[model samples]
Target chain A: MDTIDNLADNQPKLVGHDHVAQINPLLPLRKWLYSWLFDPGIPGNHQKAVDRWISILIVANLFALLFEHVDVIYEANKHWFHWFDIFSVAIFTVEYLVRLYLAPEDREFGGKKFPRLRYISSPFAVIDFLAVAPFFLQAVIAVDLRFLRSLRLLRILKLFRVLIPACRQFVKVNAGRTFRQKVHALVFAGEYGGTLHNIFDMFIALWVVVSVVAVVLESVQTVHYVLNLQFVILDAVAVAVFTVEYCMRIYSCVEEPGFQRAVLGRFKQARTPSVVIDFLAILPFFLEVFLHHLFDLRFLRVFRLARLLKLTRYTSATSTLTRVIVREWPVISAAAFVMLLLVVLTASLGYLFEHEAQPDKFENIPQSIYWAVVTLASVGYGDISPITPAGRAMTIILALLGIGIFAIPAALFSAAFSDELTKEREKLKRDLYEMLADGVISPDEAAIINREARRLHLRQNEVDHMIEKARNDRESVADLSGLPIHRIAAKPEHAIEHYKALLGQIRQLGILTDGLQFEQLARQADRLTSSELALWRQIHGNHQSQP
Target chain B: MTDTPEQSGVPLALAPALTLADMSFLVFLAAILMAVVWLGRIAYLEGVKTEVTKASGEAWVQWFTEASPKRFTPGFEPSSCAGGASPAGTNGKSAGSDAGASVNPVPERLWEGCLESLMKDVEPIAGLRNPFSGKPLMFAAKCDTDDRSLVGAMVLEKLTPTPPGSAVAYTTSSLVGADIIERKLQLRVTVCDKGAYPIRIAEVEF
Candidate 1:
């Protein structure tokens, strides 16, 4: 306790004399470290960044462990691996020690009499200890080298510090009666999944990267010779994991709102683009194993790289891109049609002009189309160029036209991506405003906001700013209630926006708007002018008329 | 690799047998065929590259393991490769006694003041690696109590290492049960090859 106080005293003193600070001199340092490691509720604490670094460190340790087993790699980077291990051990030891010391302040254990003891026995604490124990043990004890290596492998379990809590939260959130509902909660990334679904998403995404890398590495002759068995094993494991995930998705797909009919729902789910990608990811392996004798299906092995597309399921950017493409499909297709027409027209003209001078090169329109495409794409390969003056002039004109025409799609895609991102941000702001309407963010609402913020890649400070702006917007809308009739008449757009906000607020009232509340709202409504009253009734009637 | 329909045993339906009612079915079948063709085209474009060259008449297969001479069979011997030869003695193990006989006794309570990772169980602990240092750290004891039912004393000696040339070798040592007078005990013992890792006991209880 004195050591903790001394450590606290050495730091710049805070002015607060709160009950906690007064009772325990160690509270300041403990709370600061605790907030940094675990909680984000404390202002100025970068819990997210801390979590990210720790997660990165854990992944790095796993990579180091993997490299240690590869003889050439270990031999070459022996000093690096040794120092990296020491650095990792130091970080993990400090983390474990700090967490242990701050256990009394942790939310779950704070109320317990022996909080430190309870924390030590917790699964996360055990994992943390295991992560740091190996290095210290190796330093002090004469232990078998193989035994030490296996213990180092336990560092992988330290990831459970993040995963286990998410799993528990997911289970708690999806405490439904049916297994189908629970499975749905686990797999999908909407209301129920929160953190757990992201973890699962990340796991599948990591495998996708691994399998793609293996496929790429297999192309190298020396690497293939040395790691053929390992590559095969990794591929097999990837396929097995993807196959199980695909099966699970197909099974629980009926829990989705539209996919309620079992057979048709499963089929529909399979037909979806993401699910199709999932199927393709595992299909090549099965085809090679089962149908290779029928044909040279080893060619199908290349399709294993399609597993990379499975990552689109986890990234919001892909979804945004998909939305952009869908929204601008007509325009994009129009551009493509124009480009195709230009290619044909250019090919015909090139043949007409150059056919006489270079019969072999421009023998036919079909062959000339290749030159047309290449020329239009600005890739002027010297293998095919018109030598005749008329042909050269025509070629110059066609190339200029191609440049302009080809850029249409590129420009459109970039603009659409930007527009989509802005629209998503706007939608997030609107959601924040709606959530802030009731003046308090419920736990569920907070979770939704956090998930949306993450999906949009908005920082915590940015989200806080948005929340503040939303609160102001809500207040401004409410402020319209006390405005004079003349002022309301002067700003028609403001009145309409105010009306919509009021409707949203009233809708949120739902069955909670009892007689007293109704009377209060009625009294407030009584003060409105005839025009405002008529507009309100019209909007209200329209809303009521809708199913 | 292409085979004729007759050789492939692919039965063909007569084109003249189709009618207007079959048009929708024909379109669906064509769509399926188109999808398959598209997939095949993609696979062909991305197929694994294979290189081949004409060879002289003779061919053979050679197979061998570390202890066996290479044996050749017809039509499978690979092209000769050079520059991997090493003297036989270059890969031999160093001259040292087997690890089992290298265990040495050390002073009791050698690690008295240090932090340690520990586990206690009635059954023998298997694969008990230290959670802190991530090393195989375990000490097992079967205590003998006096008639008064008090644990008198305990001494945990490291078990003998696995015999050389055994089917499986385990590095973990077992504790032989014993009787002693003290309620608490501490000891350190060297237990690995060339005294590389020493097991130190900070404290132990029956």
Candidate 2:
């Protein structure tokens, strides 16, 4: 026992080093190779080189798969595709074997029961196997689209999930920020993609869809028979998650400036559409349990589908549609008003025309109202028909009018949706510039901008594009005072607001804009004439009077 | 003629009503619409900022200081935002053989000499990290200790002409770097490692 203790004490400590094959002379090489294979590094590092090659191979394999299907391309490059497939399969096989050999390094696959088998069964490992298995199968048997390179592409696509957790770690180290800031970073901020809050939102969104589909399918008796138990469990879990989320959101509402009040903030949040949708989603399950004795509860489950509306908060397209509706409300409302008038007038006219001829079918104007709406909306049910000559003529005119009248809303929506999209981009660009005021972005600043972008429902790619655009604007466009004048003049309608702030600041500081500042003014003024320039001059010229 | 005689075809024939096919059509439409929404969300999230940068590499910002309110942020100490690798002691630190080395901001801090600083002048765009490894990445931009805040109401436009994207109505807005971005010039930025090792940038245009 003393010898063992002494030996252990005398053993060299490898504090900085990781577990490796110490007995082997080539351990360093092996460890290096392992890192090269699995670790992420700079662009030219061996690991990045291998990663890039693997990514390129994925794309190349997809292309090869596509070309093999095209008769003309296959006829000419059949040999090339065949050679490429074999080469890829060999590399993949090597990768699989190597990974299996090093399975002990991977924590999840480090257990007994033949680590290689455990590694082989992992989702990524299975994907890697699927990628190469098809080629081997094709050599022995005929396997085609049923098993192809698409699986490999899916493996590559999942790389973001791997990268984000690693990035989120960086921010967590600086734990000095307030709980509100941290929560905001996670829940509300969008600048950074991979955060605890983002993952939570994504998960809830997925469940929302799953629950909604389950609810809808439950109505179908056949599906209900096989999936009833699963639906019940799903509902229970969804309700639990939604309830917790509802409480958490209300708890965190005070973090938002608008909802900084303790009780009032929760009230404000409850009144919001997103909050209302969330509440409605879980309300049905509660109603069914509490109100079972009051009324038949089977129909209460239909309201479970309200969960789908909650997904709109996560989805951009739905929000885009919402914005379009809001933008074109006037025109759309007018069109709807016209449609309502047509429904009423046509119903009354049809009642007069067909009352004597078909008393049973259209006994009164109230009975004809349903028929008029059906015909006018172009959703002709054909339940009731006009048998008289005058009633038939009136029906024909209303149906023709319905085609044009109903189209108005669709056209207006499309136009407004396009407008909304443009506005969103501009907003992103402006946010990018404002965030970039110092020409550098701190993590907090990045988080705030990201949150702002998320509020605007801007995606990461579009955010990057706007950032690029903003960066370029700052660099290439400088007025005499070396300020980014172009960004100020980017949108004319908002220029007055910008000018108001600028003039307000000047007045507070008691400074005048002439010479260099005047030159900056002229550059901006050249872009705007009419009322915009007048407002700019008014704000600038009256700065002394305001103080 | 008797009214009962006016009945033409079969006396007990059923009238036209909704079929399973119509219900299926409506379900299919709903399915397609949902798929479209899901796809749009996925595409939006998967957006990459490659077109503007010369390299096919990704850059992200990191914070070194505990986040402070904008109102309380003192003039950024020259080496304030860098964590682990202090910019002050970085003088003459050779960019050894390591491919991604510690950044050697000998005279000026990283992010003190670039377009990123000029745009958002308040917090110098300092913290950058690798998209893959999540290791801290660095870029040099001219950083000045200028404090800025939105003093007046910010003006927002109906649509910003610089790019195509979503719309915000009745909000304060600004046209960012319009002169530079409108010129349609590629904004080139370099990314380096903490060891001042310059990572090779592959300009792979896909």
Candidate 3:
């Protein structure tokens, strides 16, 4: 107790009483309230209160979506709908304000100086503002359209913020150590790395800005607006910014890391699937902006969506999907290529067969190709067709090919899904083993294992057996007398006496003489006996507790 | 390639045992049903392809736009071509009178004929030459009590033959003495032909 007290006195209290004392009285009260409201780890009752409120808010929004479609409901009880909206808006606004009030000072905009501006600038605060602003803005701005109230649907984004804590737990469980280690190393790669990263990041930001500006200019109603000029300007700016960023990234790597070294190292270090994704993200932008014509530029937008794969770095599920895709790439790629070949062949045949008889339908090779593509993919738009009998037969064949092509991806996913489930089960088994290492499973730990096993669709008996084995192996040195046993009378008196005599003989042989050693041996013997009894009970289906 | 209608030595005649009116009506009905079936087939095929393409990872919009132009059979051209001519003739008798009589006499056509008959009978003094054939014409009137049918009068103008085709102007006026009556009137006018067969009196109306 004295030693424990000494250790406690020596330990640094980074966020203990001193930190609480440092906080202004008013600020501390606000922080306490915020934690009370939002903190998930609050003692049982308050946590339940928070969960109930969140559920109520979710249910309210869902009800609003449903009710918004029912004009009669609104007409019959107009006040009810308005009141629901007002209540939700009020609760969200208060929560947003409390968060702003309790935000750490350093994180607030302008630190301590411009508190109001700081509060307004936060993202959640902006969400709160947007959620309620449209209603009042409608009143002040004299916009009277009832349908405009639907913009309140933007409040759905706030649900994403609510999901963040759950996503954090999911991410911690799924991300491999290699990813964490690489991120740590990259962070420490110093000024050059930082500058290069910043340049690429800035380029992306600038591209987004230019794209938005172009969209706005294109949408303008004025006769003087020139869409071609906006497109040209957007193209030029994107090219210029991307070129600079790429050049800087290339140049910086040339010094310490060496260009090839940096590139190879980064490639080698990247989690296998991300390397391909990273290449795809940058390649399209580089090709379109620096090397291609405007007509070809639009195709790059497809690759821009691929840039979303970079979110794998932040999203565990996406990363796990990427890993699964990589592991099964050979099969997937083979299937994909086969499907592509089939599409091309079918389209070519369709064009040939349908061209002469149905000139309008298969006017040219490309037109027939389109029909073949749709047919093979099973879209069958029915706009064009083969008027000839042979052409119809070919279409039938193409439709069958489409089914096969569609099934390939599904099969690949099923295989990968099962593999993932198996891996999760094994991980649960390991966790159960660790928890049961002290020779007994706590009720809480057992409950968690049961829940996880059920979630993974694993047999509970298998998990229990693994845990018992681990426990017995870990407690091989423990005293046996205090150990819980239910089957003391299962062994006859003569057998018990014989076993006791054997144990004495073993001790006399100097193999297990010390008390700790004797205890370990006894525990091992107890584990062996219990395991045998467990197996016997399992087989017989009639064994019960004897103690 | 050698299977030409001209080489077959069978004259291509405008005359048939069945009147041109019956043939035209049948053709019109057939055309409408064909169009509906064509559209329906295309729509069904397109719907199936759309669902299949979506399942195969193709974007719905891209697949739809790309497939639309290729989804239909080409429109068939008419087997025979004829030059356009004005539907009116000299002596206030219109070519539409003959063509209308050849087709089904729907209510609209009968009403138009009635209006034309009234105009001609009221203004019999006003006459003009047939614009294509350049033939002078006068009104013709015929009513026989032996047949209880009321027939409108028709005027016949001269026929002028051209290098490629010939044009003729004709009119029929039949008197309808009864308050309520259904009547059939027929007029026949023939013209010389250059490349194709000679024009025959296929069918006509008063």
Candidate 4:
């Protein structure tokens, strides 16, 4: 026992030499490079920046590869494309070489014999190699031009560096969750969808725009003449994607609270306006394909423009506008009724005064109604005019009345839209406050905040400012007298809420108290169960040691 | 009733000018493409600079050590090295003892300069430029061994027009004993354009 104690006392201490590796000068840099190139699990803002940058480069490379297929774009911007390729190749090459150099530092590679060789053989390294190999390969050998392009596409595989980890994280997050839940996460904006969901939404939105543009351009004779086949192919692809999306939404909508009923719930979802729009967006292509011979279904192509409405589903302003319209429906309808009554009375008066003088022009009340409408709307076509003095005087009075009557609905909608948008923004602020109440934003809560901000058309910095404000508000409220936990806990219905509040207060206390005093207070507390006390101590210790 | 319908009263001038819309769409699409490419180029260059600056000396040393022959060290002089290791020499026999001993590694930093010097030796049969911008070109070369023979591959790039001292191109050329003696220094030049994707433009003997 004495020997053991003596040995312990004599042992070399790491206090002063904890970072002895720092003496090598290049150790930190080597470790940092190793972290970025090989081990994404290592935490650093620089690695994330590098990953984001590489992902962007991969996307840009894919874009460049795609644009190269378009002869006109490639021809006009040949040098830009060339310079970009050189730049991409340079970066990718550096990345590949750096990764190769740093492979021996990786946990998986470092423990093995011939670590660099093993790294070279790894699947990711192979992808990295293939990404740069073609650029060099084409330079040396006479590669088939078609084959070379296909080879260039291998650069997309480099995205696995970002994608694989994201996928793993997604899977780990959703493990033991139901398939319906997974599908729901993918289709809807919430905790489950993550970055993949964002990508999926972006893809769908892109297709919507593409299909709509194709429809518009197809109407142009010259463009239709040249790109008729392309338009057809694009429309078909867009329809397929929408069809799959529609099916997925219907299938997984049961995961939603209101739509929990299995079959009937799906029916309810299918009846939703956005879902109907989604159905209509893809229906034209199918109708044309199946029913083309039955009738001149060429007119149905106009409905392809309905795809643009799909974008409204991704944004909140449309839903807010719908709410405003619904809320102000009565006033708008009354204004419409007044406008209708005035139009009919104006038509009658115009016909009575001008019928004898301009029988051919005023001909009948219905014809005069057209003139009345044209004048009322302030869109005078000059196609008709009342000749008599009484008729001219009536026309002037009616046009003046028309302007005021027509402005009522416009004014109402403008006011209501503004009011509704403000309310929605306020609601978002409330949600942000609730999120910051706990003093930390979970990934799921952050995603919800992000979605809400985007729906409100709030810029990223604006969302960040709101979050900061919410945090500040919470901090202010965290002052000694701001919230009473015992009073909050008095209501049995709010047991969980009170429990969370109590925990938060404890955490705050843990932050404020000295380590030894806090530990003593925690040990002396009898209210906490053993497990609860252990958890609190752990939390307290971690919080105190964070700096 | 007649089978043919009567034409409308609207004149051709009043009809929608599809040509104008199509032209505008094309212009819009082109502008977007150019913008994306321009932004991508700027971002990629910046990213590379940041990453490279962060991992500078040791990273390069490790990379070059793994990639190329030891002779291509930091202070290598291609003029002295290549001259000593003559193309006529087979493992330094034809080039005698003194010339063989003089053959040393080419400088890693001056690899591009080495290529430039080698290019000057080659008769100027053709000039390379960016076909679109008509700008002067620089090349990125890599040295490797294929079937026990020394080979160099060069990717020709148009130097970026803005921000001077950006887009520095480098090359590494391997010089094997028997291969250098037996074969011409094959410099397979590929122009960075889709149309020139299949190019093997130069094969110079030194």
Output the better candidate (1/4) by TM-score. 1
Using TM-score, rank the candidates from best to worst: 1, 4, 2, 3
- Model 3 segments beyond 4 Å from truth? A1-307, A322-353, A359-369, A397-405, A438-547, B1-206
Q: Tell me the deviation in Å of residue A101 in model 4.
A: 6.6
Candidate 1 C-alpha error for residue A252, in Å: 0.9
lDDT by residue (A1-547, candidate 4, tens digit) is: 1111122243222122112222333557877667544465543324666777897799889878876876656888999999999999999999888878888788878878999999999999999999989889989999997798899999999988877866765665565465666668789876667667876787799789878888898787545534444565566567667877887788779888799897899999999999999999877766655563354466798999999999998777787878988999999999999988988898899899999999998888998899989999889999998889998888888889889998899999999998988888888888878865655565456556656766777775676577668765764455423345453344454456556666788888876768666555556775556687678767666544321
Model 4 Cα RMSD, Å?
29.7
DockQ of 1: 0.01
Candidate 2 Cα deviation (angstroms), residue A153: 26
lDDT of 3 by residue, B80-143 (tens): 1011221223122222345565463332213233324433442321232222123422122332
Error of 3 at A241 (Å): 14
Q: Compose the digit string of candidate 2's lDDT tens values, residues A59-101.
A: 5676567546655557777799878878877887887778777
* Residue runs of model 1 more than 4 Å from their true location after superposition: A1-26, A39-52, A103-126, A140-144, A422-547, B1-206
Q: Candidate 4: TM-score?
A: 0.53
Question: How far does residue A176 in candidate 2 sit from its true spot (Å)?
Answer: 5.3
Question: What C-alpha lDDT, on a 0 to 100 scale, does residue A410 get in candidate 2?
Answer: 85
Deviation of model 3 at A434, angstroms: 5.2
Candidate 2, residue A50: the lDDT equals 58
Candidate 4 residue runs with Cα over 4 Å from true position = A1-121, A347-374, A379-396, A428-451, A458-547, B1-206
Candidate 2 residue A439 C-alpha distance from true site, Å? 6.9
Of candidate 1 chain B, the 10-residue stretch with the lowest lDDT total is B51-60
Say which candidate scores most in lDDT: 4
Using Cα atoms, each model's DockQ against the true complex is 0.01, 0.00, 0.01, 0.01
